[model samples]
Target: MAYKITSQCISCKLCLSVCPTGAIKVVDGNHWIDSELCTNCDGSIHTVPQCKAGCPTADGCVKQPSDYWEGWFANYNRVLAKLTNKQDYWENWRNTYSQKFSEKLQKHQGQVPA
Candidate 1:
């Protein structure tokens, strides 16, 4: 299972360096586990990831996500929105981009390829 960093991570960088896959990331003032990279090699275990060797306890590395994890990307599209939550300009651009991308994706998926 992917190792998730709980709120109890204590902001320590220990596990950050131990993960062999380098799937750990610090975002929104906390550590995050990328499920896409998590292999779940341990059997019958909860959150005791070997990658988190430096963590003080199992509880420290296990946790559910916070309500507003989007806080980390506050400036990802800053060129448009004044703030991440405030969809001012960048938000509009994102919608436009997604619409175009969606159309192209559908077109490509339906192609018979000559």
Candidate 2:
């Protein structure tokens, strides 16, 4: 199995430095885990890989989209939505992305935001 990184990655550079084989590299000016070099040494190189590990400053240093979504569903997201009263707005926002995957993504993101 190959290791991976997600869009949520904060480009922390932790994974890259922790890699033993230097398989990981930067793409589009962002650090990405290179599967070829992952080594499955998942934890041998560094303690917890340092990406998003216990650092308050890092939001999603290492992310799995499915897991992240599940965790979001678990947390007080529903309550937060009710408090914000922006639920319907976000629903419409999601509908806007109901297009073909790449097209919808392109339409939604004209430029990457920090």
Candidate 3:
């Protein structure tokens, strides 16, 4: 199974560099995981999925949930576009971007994506 990056992400590129499958990517100025290319580090040298191991947030990177689907990408894109400005988004990242992203996803999808 593949892993996912959640709104808890702080834009740190740690996950990007550690993913053995190169599944992590920057999309519309935010990090994303390409499930097709993800390996969950099952066969890789790392005992754990590197992305999760490297991520700083408590739950920023995690195994993809059953509810995750294609439509969520559009929701993610729409939400990210509104939250991508560094000055406005990152200055208070922990409380601002992550919280707003969760609130927006709950509003748009009727639940948080992750």
Candidate 4:
């Protein structure tokens, strides 16, 4: 019954402060919710889930699917390959240049230097 933060999160940290159990955290520049710590605001201070209520972006906070993939890296690679139409190339790119790409993305987002 925990909520999951999607890529749509703007890293605003709104959910971080609002979560009663402090389940939300920033990981690799994305906001993620620790399911073990999440209480879904069922009997907590808030009547509703704080993460979902505080999120600025629509659909940024969503209920964790029952069959959510725990192996995110594998799922990510598969999706990337499908979208780019280059499975091997994308796999290689992710393995070889992901760090550089992340750094560049951070810089572009003004979170780091170019």
Candidate 2 residue runs with Cα over 4 Å from true position: 42-114
Regions of candidate 3 where Cα sits further than 4 Å from its true position: 67-114
lDDT of 1 by residue, 15-112 (tens): 77766666788888777888876654354343555655668854576533344454335224433353556656677888999999999999998895
lDDT of 4: 0.81
- Superior by lDDT: candidate 3 or candidate 4: 3
Superpose all Cα atoms of candidate 3 onto the true structure and report the RMSD in Å to 1 decimal: 15.6
Candidate 1 ranges with C-alpha deviation above 4 Å: 41-48, 63-114
TM-score of each: 0.43, 0.39, 0.57, 0.56
Which ten contiguous residues of candidate 4 have the minimum total lDDT? 65-74
- Candidate 4 regions with alpha-carbon error over 4 angstroms: 67-114
RMSD of 1: 15.4
lDDT of 2 by residue, 9-109 (tens): 66666666556667678878676666555555575755554444532342334433346666577345645755578657777767666756768688679
**Model 1 quality (TM-score):** 0.43
Q: Write the residue-wise lDDT of candidate 4 on 1-114 in tens digits.
A: 678888778888888888989898886887899999998988886888988987899668877755557546545765776668864776887777988888888778996455
| Best model number under lDDT | 3
- Tens digit per residue, CA lDDT, model 3, 25-101: 99887999999999899888999899998898966887775566754775686567767845556768778878899
Candidate 3: clashing pairs of residues = none
Candidate 3 residue 80 Cα shift, in angstroms, is 26
Alpha-carbon RMSD, each predicted model: 15.4, 14.4, 15.6, 14.8
Cα-based lDDT at residue 36, candidate 4: 96
When sorted by lDDT, best at the front, the candidate numbers are: 3, 4, 1, 2
